[model samples]
Target: MKTILITGASSGLGKAIGEYLFHKGYNVFGTSRHPEKVLNSPFPLLALDLNQPETIGRCVGKVIEIAGRIDVLVNNAGVGIMGPLEEIPGDEIRKHFETNLFGPVEVMKAVIPHMRRQGAGHIVNITSIAGYTGLPFRAAYSASKGALELLSEAIRMEVRPFGIKVCNLAPGEFATDIASRRYYTELSPASAYAEVYGRTLELINQQVSGGDDPVMVAYEIEKIINTPDPKIHYKVGPFLSKFSIVLKRILPDKTYEKMLMKHYRL
Candidate 1:
């Protein structure tokens, strides 16, 4: 059986992926900052906090000790932040990147060496469709996921000769508890962005709540793992959400920007 490790498996998309793969009979180990708190998990949860670098190595080590060799590493743990770029605190931005970007990078570092020794492995980084464009209120999220996409491209090539594969799975909005965890800058009446930003925020939350089921993502991940030669990027979501990436590519720069502005009624 192929051993798989997924970060941030406590809830949301990560939990869904872990559950799907576990039932599919893969030897899956998931990471949560507090494993004991995640009760009734089908597979065991390892303690790993993305914000704590020390926990990363230990978590990977525990997986290796238990499973002997990890066939796949899924970097699915991340956080969300939203607000007018100017108003979002610098510290919060840094903290966001720490979880969404640097955390995954470090996890990759921890797992790669063992995969190299085994002479085979795959790493799937869960990115976002928002990464493809600069969304008005999700500037930091866009940058972080975009950076991970590019980083995956670079690492995929670097690890190819070692028999390890790297790819990005960018999902659009899904019905998850992400909105509850997202950090939102205060919407004060005196603030210039209060009216439009508040409206956009509500729309964003609604979109997430009404979005496609995350099981689709779990199925997609399973497909990627089973394919002999997986592509560098895989996008899963609603038709319009997936098509938005294409629209950005073909449409004029300002035209796309205008469309987005109109979508948010900004």
Candidate 2:
């Protein structure tokens, strides 16, 4: 059986992915910041707080100890932030990059040597559609994801000779605790962009309420993990978000901004 490690597996899509893969007979090593919750996992679990660089290596250690191999590493642990760019402080912006971008890169640093020795492995960085198309009030989140997508793209080439595949899983809106965790408490009590904040929050809430099922995302992830040679980028989930991304891609800058302003009712 292949061994796979997934971060942020305590709940949401990560939890669903862990459960799905374990049910499929893969030796799933799941990680969360809370070690106690590891007991709740059906598969083997380890404590891992991405903010702490050391925990990543230790988590990797756990997987290597039991399974003796890690065929896949899914960087699914991330946080979100909302509010206008000017209103959101530098510290908050850095926090998003630390958790969503650098954290995964650190894990990759720890795991790549093992993968190199094994001669083959898959690394899936779970980014977001926000990474590709900047959404209102989520500048920091989108920036972090943009950095992630770019980093993964570069790493994909660097690791090709090593027979390692680095892929991006950009999911559209999905049902998860991501909203609660991603919400920027530090940037809250919005005064500078009060109008924008309230309006964007309402739009976000509606989307979250009707988002796609977590299991659907889990299934897509499982497919990515199983494929012999998956594409460098995988886009999945809600159609509206996907359509929006395409519109942003094809339309002129002013036109796209107008559409956004109209849709956001800004």
Model 2: CA > 4 A from native: 185-192
In model 1, residue pairs whose N, Cα or C atoms come closer than 3 Å (at least 3 residues apart or on different chains), thus clashing, are none
lDDT of 1 by residue, 1-266 (tens): 78999999989999999999999999999999999887889999999999999999999999988889999999999999999999999999999999999999999999999999999999999999999999999999999999999999999999999999999999998999999988888867999999999899989999999999999999999999988899999999999999999999999999999999999999
lDDT of 1: 0.95
Residue 21, candidate 1: alpha-carbon lDDT? 97
TM-score of 2: 0.95
At residue 235, give the lDDT of candidate 1.
Answer: 98
What would the per-residue lDDT of candidate 2 be over residues 1-266, giving only the tens digit for each residue? Answer: 77899998888889998998899888898888986845577876688988999999888987898889899999999887887887677887887788998999999999999999999999999999889967788878888998999999999999988989899999888888777776564444547677667877888878876899888877888888778888988888888887887888799999998998888888
Cα lDDT for residue 33, candidate 1? 92
Q: Estimate each model's TM-score.
A: 0.99, 0.95
